[model samples]
Target: MLAGDGKPKHILEVNGLRKTFGGLTAVENLDLRLEYGELRCIIGPNGCGKTTLFNLITGNLKPTAGRVIFEGREITAWPVPEISRLGIYRKFQVPSVFEGLTVYENMRIPYFARMKPSILGRSSVSRNEHQEIMELLERVNLAGQAGELAGNLAHGQKQWLEIGMVLASRPRLMLLDEPTAGMTIAETKITADLVQEISESSNISVMVIEHDLGFVKEVARKITVMYKGSIFREGTYEEIQADKDIHDIYLGRHR
Candidate 1:
């Protein structure tokens, strides 16, 4: 679908998405849309198929039904590597960094991944490439720790490093699964700010699935509430907060 000016209406569209394992349905006839550069949050109770949805979208697992459209093209059953090369990337709840490698070395992995020829065959990092690596480290507040082993970093720092690693790939759309999980309150707030900055400054669209209500309230401009494997409600933060049905199912009076 196109806008009035003829641009694509949404960068992503999931039509009637469904996923089942044996007798259980993880996701059920779900429909979702995301505009270019938009940030959306998905929230639901445990076992509500949040991770399953991410898996299906990223082609880590095949959908039982429906189509996933990206930039106006259908990519319902694309392979994982193909989907990733098309500028769709996902970061899981756990940090997937190379623990024994230095933070700089970890960043080098994805940076080289996007290049035509493998940099692994090269002897040393180019001057320009080194500058780019340092810049990404700075963005994640890890410039000072570039030489430190990733395994030595704190929990929150590891998460940030993983995010920086993904940023190196220069993805157009990012799927973050519980980015702030296991983070302290202060770290969560910092993550919220970083996510907002990434979207505004880099113009990358982001879809996040998080269980942290406080973090969601801080980062989400629009929130999608999922229930029983489908989108139950979608609106601005205030609208979602004021929704009685949402309150009853997910957010209690404490919210």
Candidate 2:
């Protein structure tokens, strides 16, 4: 897709991305791009560098060589907070909600995290901000639990709460690492629909790293397969499932 000015419509572009830990290379010479509001899923065997790739893009780790461009600007090596401010948010494999706080209280933290130093207190929040938090909770199906402690939520509910908190920050892109991990089969299906709803209803580009083939098939419109520290293939779910090379990789015929 292109913009009115004829530029590429990609919301993020990663060119020649590489990361190495001393003699071990985790990621090597990778190229990726995502257009605005695209939902892309990545699947690979363990240690194939999926999480490492996410860390590089989110600034948790610096790339040995690469460029991360977001919204048409280079953001490689930017600090985590700065990158987040640029509208990129990452939801890790583990849920990171505020366990001691209520669902409503947890939503307030992201808002405060983005506040300018001059206005960084509870008094700075307006009534509209409170309503916004409630609305965000409602989007995640947590409206009735707004007063409940976050720690007491079911595993799936906690995951949804974290997603809602990320949405509160108004990210342009969201990297979700196995959002359905540890959920029951029913919960996994619900999460898949939730993610699809989020992507279609919001303006955020989404990238998910998931190992569950069933879940991936349910949620991913496009899938990128990684092997031996690089992207091995990219295609639709049917294409990937039928590819002999993918079968070989999974069967341990190819390393």
Candidate 3:
């Protein structure tokens, strides 16, 4: 696909994405694409293999058969860390912040540690990197609690911290799964706004998998509805929300 400028429309493209555990298939021959700097959402019912597809894309798990191309490069089955270092970061369904460390400490670890060369074990974080981390905490509204242990943060706050950690990688594409999963109404709204801001300010594409339709509607410019291990529909928020076929399949009303 190409935009009006005749440039490639998407930065990441997945063709024939599939995953199987023995004879059980989780994702089956799925195909989808994400444009640069686009905020897209994937929504589906439990056991629909949304996470499975994410893991495949991020190289946390290998696809049984597929091609994952990013920026005109083939990345199928690349190791997770290599894929991450290549500017792809995935936020898990559960918050993965370091529980024992303070918010500041958690963010700094990845910020500094990731800079170290894997083989040489050299680390370098400029003073500006340190300053930016503080700014990030403030932006996330957790600067006051930067001294508090990450284990003590509320569910939503931890979600924010995990997001901060992913930012430390300076990724071009971020895959966030259920970012507002355990948040309250207020926190959910706040998290959604933060994602919108990050996608805008960072100029990075973000593909989020969220169950809350209202939240997805708020954060996403485009929506990809998936079910039975395949795409059901793709469109703008209003288009998909009003799509009776999407609703029918999601509601068990589609055959």
Candidate 4:
């Protein structure tokens, strides 16, 4: 879709978005956009409203002001499930997976949710559905661990499994909040590669909130820096890194 300005509409747009809790303003007039198939990173010190922005966009929290637009449609204050149905899905900082279920079983849930079969209908997985699950598992590097219980997987493996589960929902836009948290350097690097591959192959627009500079440098095609509940800067990874003001914010040289 094209906007009135004769530009291609962004996959996601947050215009004058704001959120507040009592006297505290968590997000302040934040405007951001994600182009189709773009991989963008949001980086800021703690309390800079990165996660809060995700919350507002995903309908976990209604904004005090402004709009959340997805695919040129206004979705402000839509319920969480409604937003999710509209093709937005998020992975929280902590890995959320079915610990008691096998990795393959965990992958089935989102597919089932998407399919929404009749209660009286056969619940058996179709041959094509089975193939789809396997392909998704392979993409997340968990095909070998399909039969293993999710809780038994390593922390990084669990994270990957959860990501695969999210992907099975066929989201047009994916929000990953600190996806590499608690991962080692090697795991982090692998995640960067996986995210890039997903973006490239699936044509999914991905917005990531990350605190790790290394991960941001590796994965971010573009970066947005937030400070004091608003955008401080937006640029390429190199440009962001070269900015002394951003450095000062990270180093606590400025509030």
Best by lDDT: 4
Candidate order, TM-score descending: 4, 1, 2, 3
> What TM-score would candidate 2 get against the native?
0.94
Candidate 4 residue-wise lDDT, 73-170, digit = tens: 89999999999998899999899998999999899888767764564255688898799999999999999999999999999998899899889988
Q: In model 4, which runs have C-alpha deviations exceeding 4 angstroms?
A: 1-8
Better of 1 and 3 by lDDT: 1
Number of clashing residue pairs in every model? 0, 0, 0, 0
CA lDDT of every candidate: 0.90, 0.90, 0.87, 0.91
Put down candidate 1 lDDT per residue, 1-255, tens digits, no spaces: 998888789999999999999999999999999999999999987787888888988999999999999998899989999999989998997888999999999999986676677545775888988998899899999999999999999999999998998898888999999999999999999999999999999979999998888988898689988887888899988898888888777644322
Candidate RMSDs in order: 2.3, 1.8, 2.5, 1.8
Model 3 misplaced regions, further than 4 Å: 1-8, 117-126
The local distance difference test score of model 3 is 0.87
Q: Which stretches of candidate 1 lie over 4 Å from their true place?
A: 117-119, 251-255
Candidate 2, residues 1-255: lDDT per residue as tens digits?
468997767998999999999999999999998988899999988888999999999999999998999888899999998999898998988999989999988999888888888888555557989889988888888999999999999999999998998899898899999888888898888888888998999888999998888888998599999997789999999999999999888777884
Tell me the tens digit of each residue's lDDT in model 3 across 1-255: 667887677889999998998988899879998888888989987888999999998899999898999876889999987888779988999998889988888888766556547633544546897798888888787889889999999999999998988887788899999999988989989989999999989878999999998898778588888888888788888998888888887778888
Q: Scored by Cα lDDT, where does model 2 land? A: 0.90
